[model samples]
Target: MYEQISHSLLNDILNRIKPDIYQKDLRHFYTRLGANFYAIHGLFAKLYGNREDFDLQAQRLVETMARQYIKREDELKQLDIERERDYNWFLNQKWVGMALYANGFADDLKDMQSHLSYFQELGVNMVHIMPIMECPEGQSDGGYAVSNFREIDNRVGSLEDLRSLSEEMRSRDMLLAMDVVLNHTSDEHEWAEKARTGDSTYLEYYYTFESRNIPDMFEQSMLEVFPETAPGNFTWDEKIQRWVMTVFNNYQWDLNYNNPAVFIEMLDVILYWANQGADILRLDAVAFLWKKLGSTCQNEHEAHLILQLLKDCCQVTAPGVLFIAEAIVAPSEVTKYFGEDAVIAKECEIAYNATFMALLWDAVATKNANLLNQGIKSLPNKLERATWLNYVRCHDDIGLGFDDKDIIQSGYEPQSHRRFLIDYLTGRFENSFARGLPFAENIKTGDSRISGSLASLVGLQYAIETGDVDAQENSVKLILLLHSMILSFGGIPLLYYGDEIGTLNDDTYLDDPDKMDDNRWVHRPNIDWGKAEKRHTPCTVEYDIFNGLKKMITIRKEINVFSDFNNRELVDVGNPNLFVFNRFNPQKFHDRVLVVTNFNDQPQKLDLEDVASWGTYKQGQLFDLHTRQKPEIFNNTLVIPSFSFYWLREM
Candidate 1:
C-alpha cells in the first residue's frame, strides 16, 4: 500500500501531527495510518485533488482520524483486534437481527434496556434501533433529518442512556446497530443556520447556487425521490436567496462531498459513533453521496470512491465497527454498494436485499414462485466477505423494483403486472384479502409502492375484521411461510418490530397531521405490551406468530450450512407454485438442507427424482427440520401442505 507520492504526503502529515497524539500511542496509530494512507490519499485526491490546500486537507484528514483513535476506549480497541483476527465473523449464521424504533418498542432508551430480555426471548441477537439523532420535531424524517450528529434526541434518551443500552446489549452478547445519516442534514442543523447567516466557509459545505441555471441543468437527469411530497431536487432558501440541493425533502439539505472539509468532518462523525459502541453503523442514503450534472445523481462512480475512502478511514481507527449500506437500488446496482472488490467488501460489509424482498411480495400476491425463482436467479452474487440483510418487511414502503426482463420471463407484462400488484395489495381487486395502502403513486408513470406491516398485507387485518377463523389460520400460516423463506435465504433475516406478534397496520398515524401524508407510518406501530402478553397464550394469533418466528430463529442459529458462503443452490422443480433451494456447509459436503416453500393454497408435490442429485432425496428418510417430523411422501414425491414450507434434511 506504500506509494511514493502518497507516502511522501503521509510522512509530511505524520511529522506535523501534534505531540500529544504522537506521544499517547504513536506506534499503534502510526502503523494503521501508514497502512491505510495510500487508499486514503488516492481517494481524497480523486475527490479534492484540484484544491489549492490539498496537502493541508490531507494533513487535516490524518489529524481527524488520530484524534478519534486517541479517544477510542481500550475495550473497543481490544474488540477491534478480535474482529481483525476473525474478519469473516459477521458472515456466520447465528446472527439474527430485528429493526425497531426505540420509542415505538418502548418508552425510551432506558425502557428499551429493561426489555432487552424481550429480544432474547425471541432469539434475536442483533438490534437495529432506528435513528435517534436530534432533529426538528415535525421536520424529522423518522429521525433521518439530523440537526445534531453527536446528541441523541431527548425524546428517545440522553447519550448516557444510549451508552447504558449498548453496554447492556453487549453484556447479553447482542450487536447494536444505529443509523448515521450520511447523505444530508436537517435544514435546522447548525451548519444550515450558519449558512443562512451568510457564512461563506460553512455555506460551501452544501450545494448552493445563486441562480437557477445550474439547478435547471441538473434537474434534467435527476429523478424526483418523493414526487408526491417533495417534488424537486433543489429547494429555494429564502434566507440565503439561493437554491440548495434537497434530494429528500425541503428540510433536508444535501452535503457537498466535493468539499474536502465536509468529507473529513463526516469521517470524524462515523468514528465518533463507533467509539460509542455501535457495532454496526447503517450509512443512510449512501448512493446519493456524489452528484454529477448529466447523471441521475445516484450510484455515481464518485459515490463508490467516497464509501471506499470512508471504509479505509474507519479501518484505521475503529476496525471492529461494520457498515450496512442503505442503498436500496436495483439488484444489479445493489451489490456494488458492497464494492467491486472480489473478496473484500471495501465499501460496506452488509446491504439490504431489496430485490429479494420485493420478489417475495410478488410471489405472495400471484400465488406462484415463477417470478421469485427467476428474479432470484438474475440477482448478482455478492462479494465473498459481505452478506445480506434479508427481511419480509421494514420501516419503509416496498417498491416493486424488479427487472422487466425477469417479469417477462415469468410470463407477466411488466407494466400491467405492477398495476395488478398495487390493486391486489390495496384490496381493490375482488377476493383480495390484503389491507395495504398505495404509497407515493406517480400519476404520470403509473408507478407506485406498497406500505403496510407484514401481518396486514398478508391478510391478518382483513381476517380479524371479518372474524373468519379459517381465514385467520391461513393468514398465520402465510406469515410463517414468508418468514421461512427469509430465514433460509442465506443471509441475516431481519425481523421488523411488532411483526413477531402479527401486529397490524396502525391507522392511528392517519390522525396525525405530520404523519398523515406518509402511509409508511402505518406499519410503524407502537408495540402494546398488553397485547404482546397474548403471545404466550396458546391458539392466539399472537402466540402462533411469536412462537413460530422464535422457533425459526432458534433453528437458524444451529445450522452452520445456513451461513452465507455462496452455498445456496436454487432448484427448478417444474411446479410453478413451489420455490425450492438447497443450503450446504461448504466445508462439509454431507451437511445439507433442502428448503421447499409452497405458495399455493392447496397441497403441492415436488418429485424426488428431479432432485436425486441433491444427495439422498431419492432413498434416505427425510425429516422436516421445522416440524421435526417426517414429511408425507407418496409415489416418489414430497407433499407440501397448503401455505406451508419445509426444511428437509436427510436422516
Candidate 2:
C-alpha cells in the first residue's frame, strides 16, 4: 500500500508538523491519510504543479488535512471507520429524505429539534436543512450568497444549535445534510472586502480583471444563467474599478479556482462543516466551478478534476461524510459528476436525477408514458457506488432542459414541444388545468421555465377551486402515482416538505418585496402546524395525501429489491398510458417486483402475458404488494384503475 513518491512526501510533511498542535490519538487519521495520500498528491500536482510555489502549497495541503483530522471528535472518527467497512451503506432502500429550509420548516434550529417526531412519524430518516450560512440581507439567493463561510446566520440559529441538532438526529438514526456553497460567495465576504482595498493576495481569491476585453471573449460562448434577471456574466466593480465574474448574481462573485490558494481555502471550509457533524455536504453550483474562454464554462473537465481532488482530501479527514452534487445539467453531463471510474464513484457519491423528475412531469401533462419511457432510456448509467436522489418537485423553477435529439426520438419536434409544455403548465393551452406560472421568460429565445408547487402543477389546486369530487379523487391518485415511481425507481426517494399535505401555490412571497421577484418561493412554504394536524382526520385533502405517502413509504421499507444497485429494467410496454419497469434482487433474480403505473385518467389493462418471462410464477398468480391483496385478473388481463399503480410480485 506504499507509494515511494507519496510516502517520501508524507515523511517530509510530518517533519514540518507544528509543535503546539495536540495529536492525542491519531491512529485512524494517519492510517487513512496514508491510504488516500497518493491520489491526493497526484490530483494536487495535476492542478497546481506548474506554479513556482507548488512544494510550499503541497506542505500546506497535508498540514490542513492533519489539523482537521485532529479536530474531528472521537465519536465521528468511529463512525468513519464503521462506514469505511460498509462502503455502500448510503444506497440502502431504508433511507428516506426530505429537504427544507431552516426557518420555513420551523421557526429556528431549536424549534426544529422539537419537530423530529414529525419526520419519524412519516418514516423519513434523512433530513437536508437548507442553507443557514451568513448572507447579505435582501440580496441572499435563498442563502446561496454566503457572506461568511464559518459562521451560521443568527436569524436561523448559532453553530451550537446545529451541533445539538446533529447530536439529536444521530440518536434517532437520522442523517444530517447541510449546504456548502462552492462556486461563489457574497461580495461582502472578508476576502472580497480585502480585495476592494487593493490587497493583491486577497484579489487572487476572485476573478477580477482590469478591462472588458477578457469578459468579452468569455461572453461569446457563455450563455447567460439568469438572462432575464441579471443579463450578463460579469459585473462592474466600481470599488476596484475592474470587472468581476458574477455568474449567478452581481452581489455574488465567482471564486478563482485557477489560484491554488483559493482551492486550498475552500477545501478547508468543506472539512470545517464535516467536523460540525454534517453527514452529507451538498455542493451547490458545482457545474460552474471552472471557467474557460471560448466555451460554455459549465461541465468543464477542470470542474470534475476539482471535485475529484476535494473528495480525496475529504477521505483523508472524514471518510464517513458523503457529498451530493447540485449540478442540474443535461442527462449526459449530469452523470459526469459521479466521476469516470467504472467500479466506484471518485467524485460524488450521489447526484440529483433531474432527468427523471422532468420526464415524470411530461407524462403528467401528456397523459401518456411515450416521452417518459423514451427519455428514461437515455439516462446514463451511474457508477456502481453512486446512486440518484429522486424527487417530484423542489424549491426551484423547473427548467425544460431536455436534449433535442431525445425529443425527436420520441416523435415530437423539440422547440414546439417545449413551448407546448409551457403553455400547458401555465394554463394558456385550451382546457389545461395546471396553475403553474412562467418564470424567467427570455423574450429573445421564446423560452421560459415553470414554477409551482407539486399540488398546483398536477390539478389539485384546480380541483379544489372547482369543487369537483371526481377530479379531487383523481388528483389524489395521481399524487400517489408519482410518489410510487420515486419509491420503487431503484434509488433514494426524496420527498419535499409540503408535498405530503398537498400544499398549494402560496402567494405569500408576493407580499415580501425581497422575495417578490422570485416565483420559486411559492413552493417553499412555511410549515402550517394547524393545517398539518389534519393528516389524522379522514376524508380531508391533507389526510388523503399524507396517509397515501406514509403507506407507500412503509411498504418501500419492506421491499428488498428497491435498494439502488442498478437492478432496474425498463419495460417497453405497448400501452403508452402505462409506465412499466422491473425491480429484482441482484443476487436472486427470481425475487422480483414488476411495477405498472397508469398516468392516464382512463382505466388501462396490462396483460400478464407481456411479462411472462419477467419473473417466476407462483401458482400462475401475481400479488399486489401495496394493497396487500391479489390483483384483479380476468382472463390473464390485469385491469389497472384510473391513475393507479401496482407493485406486483410473483414467486
On lDDT, the leading prediction is 1
- Residue lDDT tens for model 1, 14-38: 7888897778865666788788888
TM-scores for all predictions: 0.99, 0.98
CA lDDT scores, all candidates in order: 0.92, 0.90
In model 1, state the lDDT of residue 327: 95
> In candidate 1, which residue ranges exceed 4 Å CA deviation?
615-620
| Clash tally for model 2 | 0
Per-residue error (Å), model 2, residue 442: 0.9
Per-residue lDDT value at 111 in model 1: 97
What overall lDDT, based on C-alpha atoms, would model 1 receive against the true structure?
A: 0.92
Candidate 2 lDDT over 1-651, as tens digits, reads 447877788788878777644345667778877888888888887888899998789888877887888899989988999999999999899999999998998999989999999999999999999999999988688999999999999999999999999999999999999999999999999999999999999899999999999999999999888898898999999999999999999999999999989998999999999999999999999999999999999999889999999999999899999999999999999999999999788999999999999899898888999889888999998887999999998888888888888899989999999999999888888878788999999898779999999888888899999997887788788888999999999778999998999989999999999889888888899989888999999999999889989999999999989998998999886898999999998788678899999998899987767876663333347889999898877777888998899999873
Best by TM-score: 1
